[model samples]
Target: MDDPMQTVYVWLDDEGHRTVLLFALAAALGLASVIYFVLTGEGSPTRLQLVLILAAGAVLFYVSLRSTAF
Candidate 1:
């Protein structure tokens, strides 16, 4: 008789878990930045900086979401 088939289990390692955590953090940061930007008045260097940060966070979050590591 043939031997029973073996089973394999796949799980996320530390780096994969870290990547997921980073993605979550980036998403939260992006969302908070958008809310803050909307609440605050416009037309200032600080506002501009916040916008830049929001954009960066969005892009990073997207990349992390699409990454295979997580």
Candidate 2:
């Protein structure tokens, strides 16, 4: 059986993998923000702020992936 960690390392070592990883992270953050917003009805100000921050992070990561100034 192939080692999963080794496979992951190999995949990340390939060109464009950084962009893929950033995209995945951004997607995860976006999903988390949406889920939090849906699950927490009448969320506190702090919670809302956290969700906004997560969404912002997701957008920034996605933009960075598309940027040439990596």
Q: Rate the local accuracy (lDDT) of all candidates.
A: 0.63, 0.70
Tens digits of lDDT, candidate 1, 12-55: 44556656666677667666766666778665536555775777
Measured by lDDT, the strongest candidate is 2
Q: Show model 2 residue runs off by greater than 4 Å.
A: 1-5, 43-45, 48-52, 55-70
Candidate 1's displacement at residue 22, Å, is 0.4
Tell me model 1's lDDT, rounded to 2 decimals.
Answer: 0.63
Return the top candidate by TM-score: 2
Angstrom error of the Cα, residue 10, model 1: value is 16
Q: Write the per-residue lDDT of candidate 2 for residues 1-70, one digit (tens) a residue.
A: 8899999998987757867666677677767767776776645535664876677686776667667875
Error of 2 at 1 (Å): 8.0
lDDT of 2 at 69: 72
The regions of model 1 sitting more than 4 angstroms off are 1-13, 43-70
